[model samples]
Target: MKPISWCSAVIKVERRAHAVHTLRFPAHLPTSSESRLPSVTSDNEIVQNIIAQAFSAIINLKHLFLLGQNSQPASIKLSTLASCTFSLCSFAGQVSGDLGIQEQLDFLLKHPTIEYWVPTEPFLRSVNSFPTNILPNLRQTVLVRPSLMKALGGRPIESLMILFIDITHSRAVEYTHGSLGPDWSTIDIISNLSRAAPNLKILTLGSLIKDDSVITAENQQSLVDAVARFCHLKILVLNTYMCALQKHTDEDPDPENPLEHSVAWEGRSPAQARQVATQFMTACPSLRRLSFPDTGPSPTNSLTYILSGTKAKLDGFYIIDNSGWWLR
Candidate 1:
């Protein structure tokens, strides 16, 4: 009998703690110790078979992590895995192109039990649009870049509970003087999530920049309005230099100089933060926690004001002295 090749042997499944299970499938099988590549068709077939076998064997698996260098298997059903993490280059590099990737992604997202999904790949430029009804049962998602937002195309996921978006890469386009491509802004992201995931309970935003020159009272109001849509939010974390501010134009410039507008010129003023806290607390009656990394001195004051004025009771709030703590 012929032995299974390295490509086939690489298919492995390991059970981890808390009922979580991981399945690792190699994208390509090595023919020799030096250098080699396996037949795309053969490798894909083996991967599909292995995944099916693993799924059948691991009935109680909760968390599934897929790790591959450059590619992923095509259209493998995973309706049972509660959480899935994909760390692949593009969908399936050589085997599945743009169209194939989209089709495969659509199939994978159809899983009914998937609650948390983290696709570590940046959005593929070839794929222009995403399916409308993707991940109907998804509850939490961690978007690493803005391209992923474009890939999702603002698809409404009514079941979403928590969302963490990091847009550190797009800062050049959003803050610096540059052509703002299809990149999304904090406001855009919040608005899209609000409309799509109305039941969102926790939202954490990173790398939010507020250029006083560009952001005015009206712009800040827009942000406030967007946040009001999260009627069920309980925990809010803003890892930003500034909260959306009230728009102030040159003609009717802010009474105080922009430099002296607040303790932290680039950050939200106590008054402004208090206003936002009040509005958010009013809109989201369940809000119990608030956190801001860049809040200047008296971070708790604004939130405290809200607690005193409104009926909202905050379990706790934090004004992170160091920015690195929240990112960790």
Candidate 2:
């Protein structure tokens, strides 16, 4: 929490707790350390102490955004998070485990009047499968995480977007796929969706990567399996990167070189993309339309693929056609 913003916001609303409805943590929550990293126990206590005190002054709060995944407090419910004893406890710093998605869910469950929930990494990382029946009024606002999807078992959701990226992970493009780039993180989430939101109408999923070749049509049968999990998934959008074919040699050019062989890669053709799209359409008979990442010979607007008979046509519709609805 930035002290300047906290001081200003508190000064403005210190006497008017009712005036504060939204509680959001910024992109970076600073601490006593120069690195500003999380997991610093003493530093985190200061943050937790400050946070625990605020809820008393914020009884009418609606939106509280926390997006960390450190050590979470065992008793993470509203009571412990806002109490004075929790503030002074030796283990007080462990409130919501570094930007807990679980904490946000607890907040959502407690406050039903909250209309819009912001996106955070923990929103997708939550595991406790809280039931939907607890608050029937929240039917439309359910934010789904992979493991948390089980909580929605036998429930329904209209729209959803699941995203995965090696953009900043150990498997990023800079890591060069480490080993054949077989680590697609979207699998388990897809499987959860299949059994969880059986009536999901519109869906979008992406495994954004630098080298699209890492997930070409050749090794995508598992993805097809995951997609088949949804009982009634209709309009679907797939965001992916298409790779151009590349070949490398294992030539040890230098005779005195200690190292032996070399390594390189592969790609996905437009034909391959079409094959995979058709696979998805076949996997989900309920699917009326689907969009795939474009394979590029030209950098033109790569369009969506919709079911036509047993195959998919590539240039008519677009997934973002309803982009305006996202603002609502």
Candidate 3:
């Protein structure tokens, strides 16, 4: 028999009145403590195997957070995770089927403990497969790509308490594809999230709307509806372009097209602007803080309508766009 040193990482999992802790480490026997250095472990396979070993031991734990998994599927092997009391869990790259997505979901149904989840782009595609009952405790989520939205599609997400979506990372070059980025469709995503995570309190959307031509009126309306569904939203942040008011006079590819006007301004119309303001005001009646960039063709009108509608309800508001332009 050979002696091997192990780095023990302990995790705590708690249920109603019970608590369980699991200590996990890598499978391969380490020669010495020096072998655990950042340079010694170069392959991700070693890291994930370590996770598997750690999670395999505990029968029932509470609040699981897989902050670091190198390359193996972490979502499927939830026999151990399901038994634990997980209020917050995060997966780095992808959660494969082998991880027992359904079993984990069933466990969540019987014992709903997860409150916050952050799964990367690769895991988003299969996220919808989780049990619906687990949604009750899911309060916050961070979406990374379009696949994530698809995974959550048709699921009741209204039960959430807070959500943060980032679509600016999309690599799509076409405006059509770009506008349909993860954050764009997030309006509908939030709608579903609202149903699943009903206590949703905070929402944030950030993208480079100035460079993309995909954000239009129809998509805007859908997003507005999602916001309208948030009965408990207190903080809302929306980031878009306000460069519509600035276009080169010499640049005239077409002058008589109405679609050009809408396209020119990132899909801004008098009616849509008014509707956005109205919907936001009506959706979050208890709103305390609102922040958004003022850009595009009708920035002034958009700001006016949003402020006017939320004036009675808003506790505080901050305008972060067009700061330098206004100074000149």
Highest-TM-score candidate: 1
Per-residue lDDT over 29-144 for candidate 3, one digit per residue giving the tens place of the 0 to 100 score: 33225455454344344544544444544444444433223333333344534433333332212344454455545644654555445554433434544444554545455654
The residue-level lDDT of candidate 3 at 261 comes to 46
TM-score of each: 0.50, 0.48, 0.46
TM-score of 3: 0.46
Give all candidate RMSDs, comma-separated.
Answer: 10.0, 12.8, 11.7
Q: Give per-residue CA lDDT, model 2, range 59-159, as digits (tens).
A: 55544543332332222334435332111100111133345555545544555443333333333444455556433332233232344445645544566
Per-residue error (Å), model 2, residue 141: 8.8
Where is model 3 poorest over a 10-residue stretch in terms of lDDT?
1-10
* After superposition, candidate 2 runs with Cα above 4 Å error: 1-4, 11-17, 33-49, 67-148, 165-192, 208-234, 240-289, 296-302, 305-328
TM-score of 1: 0.50
After aligning candidate 2 to the native by TM-score, how far in Å is the CA of 274 from where it should be? 8.9
Model 3 lDDT on a 0 to 1 scale: 0.42
lDDT accuracy of residue 133 in candidate 1: 61
